[model samples]
Target: MSDPELATRLGAMIRDVPGYPQPGVVFKDITPLLADHDGFTAVVQALADAGRDDAGRPVVDKVVGMEARGFILAAPVALALGAGFVPVRKAGKLPRETHAVGYALEYGEATLEIHQDAIAPGERVLVVDDVLATGGTLAATRQLVAACGGTVVAAAVLMELAFLPGREAAGDLPLTALLVVDGA
Candidate 1:
């Protein structure tokens, strides 16, 4: 379940930038929401909830965040959950040896990498990202976690483009999205 009040407040903060980075695509810009201290705090709290069990105890051992925007949201989520934070970056971004996985994007293909030692064997993980689009990023992140011998218990995104096939692509992964946008 989602909080209607939070959804209403945060949704208002998201600016619809039409034709951003390309034509016919409306980007859901969240810089305004990120700038609001109260809104940001609320979002982090809500996302952190995914890593907790029904008893309200943190159930994950590590929180894995994808490259770029995911880094911003996942770091604080890890802190709130009292779990370790792991960054799944683009290829060659990390100095240490890493495990990498490639996936197809809407426009092209991309690869994601994670430090081989980031997640210990048998560790439980929670994946966090700013948005769920086609679900390629989330799927790749899950593979990276598996490569590192960790299990992803759940995934949380700030927003979901409901019009896309992201939910189907995600398969059976437990997903929680704060907001769902129906169309462009």
Candidate 2:
């Protein structure tokens, strides 16, 4: 399918739950899309293309997926890009030495950690996730990649919240999303 059709299909699969984890917040749930093989593959392929160079060759050395849902989306993207997959998880989840970064949330603070040895110095990395909301998680993931001495080439996501400041929060890092929706 074309990009517009792909976006439409993906959007159709997302179910909105009002006031989910907290009141007055609508969570865009992706469980429905995850269950459909075709939908899932399309997302992976679309995201994987973000790591390619101008000539259509893979340019990333590693693909870092931010915890939880991110892990699910990024692994296959890494394979498609011919890069290694790394996980940026919540603090204390990794057993080995890690580089952690703390970021602010709408209400509080949180930390994300990545294995210290995950990336070699100067390696080009592409960070991937299921969604880009406030961008705190993504920025923290960028920090973790830098701490490991890797250069973040770009950030990819299934979707991004246009109402939030995710792009600004991510600084100069290029971010590509399959869909950009207002709010949740």
Q: Write the per-residue lDDT of candidate 1 for residues 84-170, one digit (tens) a residue.
A: 999999889999999999997654689999999999999999999988989899999999999989999999999999988888888
Which regions of candidate 1 are displaced past 4 Å? none
Best by lDDT: 1
Model 2 bad stretches (over 4 Å)? none
TM-score of 2: 0.96
Clashes of each: 0, 0
Task: Put down candidate 2 lDDT per residue, 1-184, tens digits, no spaces.
Answer: 7788999998899988988778877788999999999999999988988899888899899999987999999999999888999999888899999898999764458889998999999999999998788889888888888899999999999988888888888887778889889754
Which candidate's TM-score is highest?
A: 1
**What lDDT does candidate 2 reach at residue 78?**
96
Clashes of 1: 0
